[model samples]
Target: MIVELKNEQFYLCRHLLNRQAHLEPISVINQTNPGRVFVDDNTNPTSGMVWLGNNDGFIFFGNPHNEKFNQYIDPFIDQFLVEEAKKVDLDYMEAIGNSKDWNTTLEKVFKKRNHGNWNQRVYTLKNYEYLDKTEPNIELEYKIQKLDNRILTSVDLTNLDTLKENILESWSTIDDFCSKGIGFCIIVDNEIASYCYSNFVAGSVHCIAIETMEKYQGNKLAQKVAHTFVKECFIHKKLPYWDCMEDNDPSVAVAERLGFKSYFRYIGFDFSF
Candidate 1:
């Protein structure tokens, strides 16, 4: 039997999710707002069936001890989610985890429904790029700026009406992180042309996210802005963490130029919800 988890079952959910987190730290997707968590065994969550991850994707995990848990892994994944996805018109969703059995069962789920592979890698860099100057040394045609304390912590993204609404969603997730988070960007006509910021963080591991307006690409805007963000990280005693798909040449090159090194490789799936 399946049960949708709520606050009453938070402890059990956290315990099982953390069991998965041990294998994938960044995979510890939901922390602030708990996403939908479903479990077959509320009493022994980690010992049986469960699923987790953030809104972008999910990480499904299964415990070995329960026979009922393993028996229904495929149906729990395929039939239940397929029907739910159809109900919500869930366009895209990807699920991954540390369990081979889960992956094996996931294959059957994919065959029954529809899903595809989303491959990616995790990267990190510890050697901080220290500089004598607090400000970035790089130059740009657009005004290069560091996030001010006020806007850094919180900003009315609605004020940025010119930017694509989807791109500005970072404010919702990273606002709180700004107190400790730091970032740099190039602005053109009061619009962010290219920028880099610490998107999500776990302790000293600051995950970096950067994007340049299509028109602004190829100007080395990403590199300069990211380098500036890295300098900011050092000033604040933070370690920059970088991750990208192994197939992402530009991302890999930028990280390499910024002195990021390969940390580990893990399975990543890409599919529609």
Candidate 2:
């Protein structure tokens, strides 16, 4: 059965770590140190899987596909979180996800915190099939090669002195998550022009922020980098997930051109912030 740790519990911690080891590594999840919440049929209190990390809040990571754990264990884990929230006098707790099963569970437990309706979020991407037919002209080729060269030469941020101030200032901890996957940059005549990266969550890969220098804005390097990144994700057997503010037209266009289909949309509730 599922168990919630009242305090530090070593065995439950081990089980959670073991479960993470078997799953496709998610960098965002890895960066957080949120402790464990348990699951398993073993009568021993320490046995079974535990969900680890805190995104906006706690994350549940146990195998939903396991028959015994899925049926007997997961519900209790859900109940445990809700009960714990009440016990701690938490005004609100929320879970964010694109999964129907997760939404169903959250619907039953979390009081629909997105107001009257769940947030409408979309995921879209273009694959290699869409990208292959597009040929870059001489100008486009020059820009793409410039970007490729910049990324290859300055794999780390330190060597990119000219771009360092702006990049480091704007970089997100989430960027570290993107680094765990594919990252690329565009350079123009030895100058860093633009760059993009992907952050993988389970099999879903989301493209992180792409930025172009003011001088490079009209060159379409952002589009090229994005297309290349999506191609890489597909080659790696990962689905590239593109999420942007609902009003972000440029991002939406890039994702559409790259062959990403809009799947679902979500709204965020930031109780913590």
Candidate 3:
């Protein structure tokens, strides 16, 4: 009884919004991000799941006890999702459930292929007062720059390909990222050493993703770039969001140092094909 919903049918999933544990699903359902939604009932969906267009992952929302929907989960994964993942050359599937009940359902259904679990932490910046406003002193060899159009689209820019790939992992396209997302980077001798960007945006909230070159890890470049990105979010009246693996000590340290408070925790699962 499951069917893929068209763009117009996306609103039908609204009732299940309250169960969402992350902002990605909201961005997808709102049509502000690219993704596909499948539901048990298109007209009055009681349960549904979103397949992120970026091929990064999936999110499950709505009634966990819906018998019909639960029955379809297996085929949805073993068949439909498997074929779709092939297009992107993905060997595994990563997923998140909106609630504990949904998580339990996913655990049961994916039990055969489930490889591991990820403990994720979500952080919120309630007030700018917690922000460490101290600016990082960069060595003269390193310079910070905005991820502008030139940097986004320039083919010959040093490390631009890697940068674009990382961005597109979360964003649908470089053009879309340029239009809606914000980013900052640290450049060392014309090579990108570290960067941060809005990984997902739902309404006025933006979730941040950051990375630093292995050689540049100890320099606090992530914090510097994130500070710039978050400050930009504030100037534009947007809320900065931070999400990371629970065991990611460096990410946890940076977020906390930036004044973001731990808001919630969620579980993620990876299923091997």
Candidate 4:
């Protein structure tokens, strides 16, 4: 029951998870277009899986093993994982880890011996409910040419001067999705009030961060912008996934208003400084 890495098996693992939920396959193994190592047990194509990239090893995805498989092969898989870690120089800071059984291994692999400090959070779309009656405070609008408007431009984060001058800087990540994904702004007269962007991944779409200016707080512009983005995700046949720190209440509140539910909790650990 030795598990060996293979390419087709990796794709099957990804397909299985996508069928179950909107989770993003961890970036550790899937860093390259057609990545490196992929794992499989001889008897079961997906008894367990592992993926190794340039410098890091990842247990990218896995299917649960039966009692027989667990007794016969789980130990070998564990040993294989440790050996892979050593081979790749797996530094937690530089490496990404994702697995179905992360809760069990998090402490052994991620924790500082006695300190044991870790934080995790996850959120999902709860129920699909349409806004039958719009509230007065909730303002929703759409503009096809919003990106062309000069005032709606995102604050540049590349230049040192622009980065230092602005309290909020633009995200270059969403720039690539310009015409395809939704570009929205909650405006006040000619000024940009707040903004949000949505993007598609593996047939599903999710909203990234949305923010309102500090001076415009308490006006619910953040919620408005987020709701608008969520609606767009639905239209595109992509479910919106919300990810944020557990303590980020404001962002979580907006998700709740938009009918997002908590699906799984994920904690990130960085051991290498």
lDDT of 4 by residue, 1-273 (tens): 555545544544544342343233432223222234444454345444344332322333455433333343335434564565666465343222354454455444334333233444555552355441332264444222233224334453123232122312222232434534455666554455667654223344453656676877787777766766666666666666676667788887776667677766655444432
How much lDDT does each candidate structure score?
A: 0.58, 0.48, 0.84, 0.47
Best-to-worst order by TM-score is 3, 1, 4, 2
Deviation from native of the Cα of residue 15 in model 4, angstroms? 5.4
Using all chains and alpha carbons, the TM-scores for the candidates as numbered come to 0.72, 0.50, 0.93, 0.55
Compared with the true structure, what per-residue lDDT tens digits does model 3 show for residues 100-207? 777889888777774688999999785555566655776788788899888776665688889888887777788888889888988987789999988788988888
Q: Where does candidate 1 stray beyond 4 Å?
A: 7-30, 47-54, 62-67, 70-74, 77-89, 99-102, 128-140, 148-175
Among all candidates shown, the one with the greatest lDDT: 3
Residue 183's lDDT within candidate 2 is 59
Q: Give the TM-score of candidate 2.
A: 0.50
Runs with alpha carbons beyond 4 Å of true place in candidate 2? 1-120, 124-131, 134-180, 201-209, 271-273
Which candidate leads the pack in TM-score? 3
Tens-digit lDDT string for candidate 2 (82-103): 5665654554544443234444
The TM-score measured for candidate 1 stands at: 0.72
**Clashing residue pairs in candidate 3 (N, C-alpha, C atoms within 3 angstroms):** none
Report the Cα lDDT for residue 224, model 1.
77
